[model samples]
Target chain A: MSMLKITDLNVYYGSIHAVKGVSFEVEEGEIVTLIGANGAGKSTTLNTVAGLLRPRSGSIEFEGKSLVGVPAHKMVSRGIALCPEGRRIFQDMTVRENLEMGAFTRTEEESLEMRKRVYESFPRLKERRTQAGGTLSGGEQQMLAMGRALMSKPKLMMLDEPSMGLAPILVQEIFDIIKELNAQGTTILLVEQNASMALSIANRAYVLETGRVSMSGDANELLHDERVRKAYLGG
Target chain B: MGFLTNLINGVSLGSVYAIIALGYTMVYGIAKMLNFAHGDVIMVGGYICFVCMNNLGLPVAVAILLSIVGCTCLGMVVERAAYKPLREAPSLAVLITAIGVSYFLQNSALLIWGADPKVFKSVVDLPSLKFFEGQLVVGPINIVTALTCVLIMVSLTLFTSRTKMGKAMRACSEDKGAAQLMGINVNTTISMVFAIGSGLAAIAGVLLCSTYPTLMPTTGSLPGIKAFTAAVIGGIGSIPGAALGGVLLGIIEIFAKAYIGTQLADAIVFGVLIVMLLIRPAGLLGKEIHEKV
Candidate 1:
């Protein structure tokens, strides 16, 4: 049932070992969240799986196929998409153009269809379809990023810090959207610093600390765990 | 020649500059590197066209097509060999390599074609136009160059703004990582840009030599610099900007020569550029980098 799997992922930036022996899995139709503090390997692990970062030593498998050494651009065509840490939308490009770019590997007809579907899910993006990406508000930018990722029609979508800078209201809106997406049969791998919100929506959770998996369990069970409550949920 | 005649000549010259500037602007916008060697590609194109038409006895249209194809390949090879390995290296390194490539192209031409100048045959086989008791004249090359520039500009704008590949190119220019996330191959897009730019260089070369009627190892250097200046004037990364800059620069150079001392014309042209930049640092159509805080 595992749609995505990673084992012993080790990533380094020059001499700094960022992600060391970080392993995890995302089963089909499940919301798997990785929760951790600053400098934790959460983003690093997500990027490694997304094929953006070269692992020092590890293996990444998607639907039973090896994903290691695959370039980031090739990952989307393989049914894996990463909505990166920042809402790194092409600022000068129109919303429609940004979405079109998301489906780069798809045929013209398929991309147009995907664009219509994305617009339906994010009506606000459709409203500003011709507007430049940089002009959108933070919440709208987040929606555009998520919608842009969906344009690829990936089997598993990985999000890194999607709620990082959003207001509480916008954070709630984004989480709702994520849940809505998962409910529609899309598998989600979410890496978040906001432990409580991520745990609430996630089916399962993994806790990373200083480049390793410190703890992990059923999302609800970890939510009640005393140590997790003390460290992440603010006691 | 009347004022109308002078204006047409300026516009014709500017058309060639605009075409060359498009190559500079497109590559700079997407790859974020000033392809200094882009100008030398023009010289290479000119030589290729000359060989095909003169030695092989090919027709004008076929010679130009062959030249474009050859330049496109050269651009890709240059990018792969010189620029690709240094993609992650500093911009300065890439720029130095481009200068090296420029010199290499120049020397290669000198060695192959010899340093002796070749009298370039005008590609414009059409008739020239005359008006107002034959006081004002428009050379066939002028009409051809202007139309070609306009056509190229319109198509390039449409291609970038409307097509999927064009959108991918814009995305890569903005953010390579995000573009990659969207399944766009950044390397391939960069290669495509070089291809387009160099192909344009070929057309510009033929048009340039046709108007000037002289071909040498350094035929493309002055015009290349002027086109680069044109690209800067219109805003380095903007497509329309390059066209505007090229035409404006061409007019200024022509007017300066006619009205001012012929010796001071180049100075006046450069002086206008200085004054223009001081007035609008981002160039005529360039967006100021002042991000909204």
Candidate 2:
């Protein structure tokens, strides 16, 4: 059963139709990936789903409730969180403060428990809890991003380009973290440029090209498909 | 005797400036845009409170509370009408709009309240408290002003450090887009910052009126400029920095008037800004941001 659904979603940036009638869905506890090169509306699609960008038209439903017109803060309250691209952590804030901010809408009791769970997931965050988030290494920041999202206790987590600009080893570590997060029953909607790693971890994948979904299928089939092979998989 | 008296005067005046400066700092911290109209909002608050107490014969406490609420709502209106539309626009455009709003508020006050100076009667009448054989005497007004400033400062610190909204404001200041993605209502946070900052300025206006007993429509403008200088001195986006900067600027101005002739005081105060900026471009506490590329 689908936990998240998007239908004919159109988002515009003042006459620039960024996402043109794009649609997809993520089943509960499933890892779904959206793969595209730069400017393919991958990030735009994720942002629209996260309610950061109000759709120009179309519907976004999370667990049968329409998420359209809901503000970003309301989205978090209703169990949706986005780890946006560029790892935009609060630079002046301490590591602990960054995580605490994720639980901004939660009750005090839930926040405390969530903090402990986040610390356990990323022990390095615990070690550097006092340090400013900007001071963390690239790999540490990616972990911090994932941990911060986990603090919100969102049922559907959207990660945008988590592997971008990281070393190969750190990229593998981030992918492994995504898999682990899914294993723990969190529904994932990931947008990535790394098709190989994304498809490897994803249960299903969509191929976006120039503001529309060009193709989509089970992860293994798309990984083996001829067109997806030449265009995205670097065959 | 003169030295002690001047010190008291400096601190009292500085406390007022510090309150106003906090408004500038808070707005700049979160929005990264100077709400040029912020000082005029204080003037509006003062005029409203003055009319409430003096014109309508309302009780002083009631008048003050209404003025605060009035200022808060006015601030939210400014955010909604002026700042909100320009959120994604260029910084310069928002700044120009802020200046335009400031001018509009001041002129409207001038037309409504007139250009004449009006007296702001003291809310409470208590005799001075003396210390050291009367060498050091603090009046009830001065004591209240100092204590109120300290109390507000402490509360502001606690709010920024301990509260969830405060944390979100700080995060938004650091990176607005990221804060939005984190589920913070960036628009609401910015509006809250404007309200809190304007509220602080309103308190300062009331306190200033009480101390001086007279207020003009444009009274908040000069102090606003001086407070802006204080904000720049301590750091544009730093709260503790603004307070420290304000007190230091006040002391310097006082001493310049006392020891160095009043004529040179203004020159010296401005000269200090030039020297400080040359030495530390980021102001006293503002962090210097590095280019990613």
Candidate 3:
């Protein structure tokens, strides 16, 4: 069943139409990926779904309920969490505090359980729980960002550019974590500039270009597609 | 004996400034706006307490509690009405609007209460305390004010460090967009910051009026500026920095008034700020922020 469905979404930043009539769906327990080059509106689409940006016109239905005009904070309570682009973790706060912030909508008992689960998934986070977030290495920060999002116990977790600026090995590790998370029952909607790695793990893929979804299909088919190879795979 | 008296007086006054400075620091930290009207909130708090205690004939404790509630609401109202609409506007625009609010509050007080200063009756009626074979003396107000400030500082520290709402506040201060994405209500968090800041201002107001015993439209102006300076001195966004700055500013102002001429006291305070800024631009307790390109 489709957990999140977006239909004919249009988003604007000032006069520029950033996401123009984009539509997509994330099925339950499937890893869906949006891949594109810079300025392709992939982030914009993700943000719109997360309710960070209001669409000019579109229908966003999460669990069959319309999400138009819903505030960004309310999205989390609705079981949708976005790990925003650039891993915007609170630098001044401790790692534990950042994770705690992720459980803002949750009760104390639920938060404690979530914290234990997050710690289990990312042992490094458990080790560095007392350290300030800003002091963490880029890879650790990325992990913390994802871990922080996980603290919400989201059904549909949206990750934007999770591998940006990381070493190849760290990037591989992040993808592994992503795949592991998907296998563990979190429905994932990923936005990425690393088309090759993203397509490898995704069940389905959508190619966003200049503010619209230009191509989409089974991830495996798109990986071997000549058009995708020529445009995104640097062939 | 005179030195001891001056030390006690400085600490008592400094504690009041510290309380007020907490308001400035917290509001600036979370909202990223210097609420120029914060000082006026102090005046309004004083007025509210006055009306409740004198006009309404409520108990002192009840009057003080009502003043806090009044200020907290006022702070939230000010944020929603004046600041929220201009959230995305330029900092200068917000600053100007804050100044406008400050003037509006001052003028409103002037129109309602008149320009003439009225004597404020002391709420705490405890007799003075003596120590060291009656050589050293202390007013009950001084002890109460100092202890209250310390208690408040500790409680605020615990609140910001331990509570979920406090963590949300810290997150909001760091990144509003990110905080919202985390399912933390950014609007509610901002309102909470305003409420906390204004509540602190109300307490400072009552303590200040108790000592100084004067009520006027501009009652909070000087102390407000001093508290702002204190916040900047300690570190505008750092909580401990604000407290430290307030105490240092208080001591400096008191010493200047005693030894250096009264006219040069303000000058000395500003001069100290200048020197401190020159030495450490981030203020004393403020963490140095590296701008990410």
Candidate 4:
């Protein structure tokens, strides 16, 4: 069974339908990527899955349990976490505080234990744990956001545009961490505009256009597809 | 000698303002609402403590505690009934609703307690402190108010920094949506802030009444406005700023009353606010986040 599944998801932002009948799945221990253009509902879909936005009609199943109406705060305990777009780290809070808030659903001991693991995964955050999150550089802030999500020890981690405002080297480093975390058993659902880099690391890929899935296949197959190359691969 | 006396009185009055200002600043910080009814909540707290002591004949400590709990519940209810539903509404709408709630509390108090003013008995029983051969005098209530205000400030600082719930409050203040995604019940955190802010209002009410020895439905309005001015002077959402603004306003008010004409004291106090705003619109300690964003 898939670790996460959504069937016929229809989400609306007022009169605008953001995600129309979008169905997708992320199996355990696999890296799945959703590549799309601007305003194609990639972020909206990820947000709906993370429970930030309620779908007007659809079913969201996580580990075979329905997540249709679960409030966003309760999603952490259900073994899912979203590293939101734009790295929404608390500016006034210290890095450690940011991570503590991420692990808020867990016990103090578990939070502390997970802190150690997150530090192991992203050592940069540990160095600046005492500093406020806003003081960090762009790359460091992204790392902090990702590290914070990992503090929950989520079974499935969804990242939304993690590489949007980072340097090429930083983007490569972040993708490496994503691949490494997947190797360590956390399923990954990634959304990115950098289709080439995303597809290179993803086990499978889905192309979304105007709120609907345009194509889905093994990442490498789509990477070499003639139509995929012309449209998204900058032909 | 006269200056010294006024300074002591100023500090005492300032301390009460500090307590109320703290509450104002905190609710503004976490919930981002002006909570105009906060002063009315103070009026309610004063009435509760008065009833508990005068009618029920409860001890002063228990009376104060009951007042705190009552105000806390009232604060939460006010949030749920008036503020929560309008969470997505424009802030102006919320502001209007707050003003309506304020009037509601005031009228309710008037109906329940009547228009007659009650003489409040001082809760503090300690002897007055004397210095300079009794030429300099400080009431026990003065000392107690200052001490209690200090204690509350220290505890509040520690609570927000050290405890998990406190951290949650800080997180909610920063970004509610992000905080929720971190597994925090945003509504619960906001409600807790209201509870705390209202609890502080009880203490402020008691302190104000203890010092003045009068109880009326409209008693909290003047001091409430003054404390809000103090909060603004210090920087509305900044904690220590509230204390500073409260003490400054208190000192200024006392000096104006003692030296200048008594009727002009309030005018002078408000004049200072206008001047402060003209010079530093962000208040003394408020960050420039409001700068033309």
Candidate 5:
């Protein structure tokens, strides 16, 4: 069964249609990525799924339950978490506090267990646990953002542009962590502009252009596609 | 002796300002709007306590609790009815709405309680404490006020830094969208902020009236403005900043009134604000926010 299925979704920002009739599904334990350039509505689709953006017309379902009008804050309890674009970590809070906030909807015991797992996954977070989030380096912030999202222990984790700004090595490290998280039983929905790295790690890929999906295929096939190479892979 | 007395008076008054300033800072931090109705809520709290004590003949403890609860509900109602709808509205628009709410509260109080100042019976009837061989005089009300303010500030600090709900409040203040994504009910957190802030204002109101022994429709106005100034002086979004700013402003105002001209006290307070802004725009204990591109 599909973990998340967004069908015929249309989202707008003040009458400017941002995501038009976009539809996709993420099966259980799969890493599905949506890759596109800026203005391609990749973030919009993820945000809509996370209940942050209202879709003008369409349906979002998680585990076959309609998520059309469910509020954003309630999405986590339903087992879906979105690590938003720009790595919007709470700048004033300490790193540990940010992690704690990720488990905002969980019981004390569950949250504590999740915190330990997150610390084990990202040991650097434990080292700088008391440091303010704003003080962290870009790579550290990205790690914290992912770690924070993981604190919720969601069955489906949606990350938006986790590698938007980072060194090449850091980007590789982040992708590696993403792969590891996926291997540990959390299905992933990734939105990224880094088509090369995203396509490499994703099980399936969708190419969005101008608010619509232009292509969908197995990630390996799209990685070698001629048109994809010309537009996104620097052929 | 005069200096010592003035210092005590400053601390007492500053403590009151600190309590009210906490309301301003917390609401502003979480909601990003200056809740101008905050002062009127204080007035309402004062009136609630007055009615409970004088009209209904309740004990002081119950009266205080009822007033706090009343103000908490008022804050939540104001947020739900007025500010929540305007959450996405322009800051200026929300600000204007707050001003409108403030007027609504004041006018309603005026209509109900009359324009005449009502004498507030002394809630704290403890005897005065003498210091410096009885040269300096201090009332028990002053001591209680200072102690209460300190206790509240410390507890609030712990609350925001330690509790789960408090952590969510900080997150919401930082980035509302991100906080919501974390499955935090942003609306509930904001309402909690209003509840806590208004509850503090209620206590401040009771202490304020007890100190001055007068309750009027506009009783909360001057102190409210002063507390706002204190919030700005300490850094509007920083909790510790509010407390420090309140105490400093109180001391400065008191000293100015003692040595400087009485009319110049307000000017002095504002002048200090200007100086603080010019020297350190972030205020004491306030973090400098650099907008991310």
Candidate 6:
């Protein structure tokens, strides 16, 4: 069984159909990228999977347990965490406090261990542990967001626009960190507008457009495809 | 002689205001709700203690405990019924709901306790102690009030900083949606915030009643206003800030009344507020975070 699976997931924002019967799955310890333009329902799909939005119709099964009505916090306890878009770190809280909040569901000792692990992954965060999250630079804030999500000690992690608003150098570093995290046995589900970068690291990838999965296959295969080259890869 | 006595008086009075201010800070921190009904909750607490002592022949300690419990439940109910439904509603609606709830509680207390003011007997079985050549006398009520406020504040600080539930509350304060995503029950956390805040308010009420020995339908209004001012003065969502603001306000009130006269105290308080607003809009302890567009 896959670590995470979505079957005919449909979501709505009042009258607008934001995710129309989308389906995908992530096996354990693999990177899956969902590439799309703005308004392609990329965020909606991620939000639904994270249990932030209740899907209007569809089934989300994580490790064989249905997640249709399960709340977002319960999803975290089930070893799934969402590093939401825009790096929504708690602005008023210190970096350490924001990270601590991620492990709020776990026991004290485990959470402390997780915090140590997160700090190890981003040593810069350790240095700025006492600094308010809002005070960090854009790249640092992104690292904080990822570090915070990892503090949950999840089996599957979903990231939305990890490279948005970052410098090119920081973007490469961020992607490198993502790969390192994935290599360390964390299953990843990423949504990105940077199709080239996402496809480069992703083991498998899907192309989404206007609330539907327009294409899916091996990341390398999609990268070489003619239509994908022009529309996504900037070839 | 007058200055020293006033200083002591201010610190004691400040302690009472600090107790009341905790409710405002806690509720505002977690739920981001101003909770205008908090003052009335204090009044309700006093009435409960009074009834338990006078009508039911309960001991003062039991009456205080029962009153705290009752006020905690009252705070919870207000959060659920008055604020929960309007969680996503506009600020105006919630503000109006708060006012309505405050009025409803005040009227209910009037109906139950009548329009009479009742004196609360001192729980501390000791006389006043004098300091500085009889200029400063430390009364039992004042000492008790300060001690109780410090105890509650310390526990509250420990709860927020060290305990799991307290961290959850802080998370909710920082970001409600994200806290909910972390599997913390948002509603339950909110209820806990209200309970703690209102419970503190009840303590303040009991303390004030012991000192002033008076209870009326609108007993909580003046103290409530003072506490709200303190919350703003110290930074609304900062816990330690509220306590500092309360103490500062208390001292100012005492000295202004002692040196200048009681009439000048209100003017001086507002003047200080204006200066604070001009200097730091976020209050003394609050750090501002700007959003990137």
Each model's C-alpha lDDT? 0.92, 0.88, 0.93, 0.93, 0.93, 0.88
Most lDDT-accurate candidate:
4
Q: By DockQ thresholds, what CAPRI class is model 1?
A: high
lDDT of 2 at B271: 90
Off by over 4 Å in 2: B56-59, B129-138
Residue by residue across A84-199, what tens digits does model 6's lDDT show?
A: 89888888778988888888788889889998998888999999999999889999999999998898888998999999999999999999999999999999999999999999
TM-score of each: 0.98, 0.93, 0.97, 0.98, 0.98, 0.94
Instruction: Estimate the overall C-alpha local distance difference test score of candidate 4.
Output: 0.93
Output the number of the DockQ-best candidate: 5
Clashing pairs for model 5 are: none
> Over 4 Å off in model 4, which ranges?
B290-293
Query: In candidate 4, what are the lDDT values of residues A10-96, reduced to their tens digit?
Result: 999999998989999999999999998999999999999989999999899999999989999999999999999999999999999
Over 4 Å off in model 5, which ranges? Answer: none
TM-score of chain A by itself in each prediction: 0.98, 0.98, 0.98, 0.98, 0.99, 0.98
What TM-score would chain B receive for each of the candidates shown?
0.98, 0.95, 0.98, 0.97, 0.97, 0.96
User: Taking the candidates in order, what DockQ does each have?
Assistant: 0.90, 0.70, 0.90, 0.89, 0.92, 0.65
lDDT tens readout by residue for model 5, B108-212: 999999999999986897789887789988998889989998998899889899999888888999899999988889999999999999999999999999988
Can you give the lDDT of residue A57 in candidate 1? 94
RMSD of 2: 2.2
- Residue pairs of candidate 3 with colliding backbone atoms: none
Q: Distance from true position, residue B268, model 1, in Å?
A: 2.4
- Candidate 3 TM-score versus the reference: 0.97
* Candidate 6 local lDDT, B175-260, one digit each (tens): 87778767688889999999999888888888888777889989998888888888888998888888888889889988988888
Per-residue error (Å), model 2, residue B242: 0.7
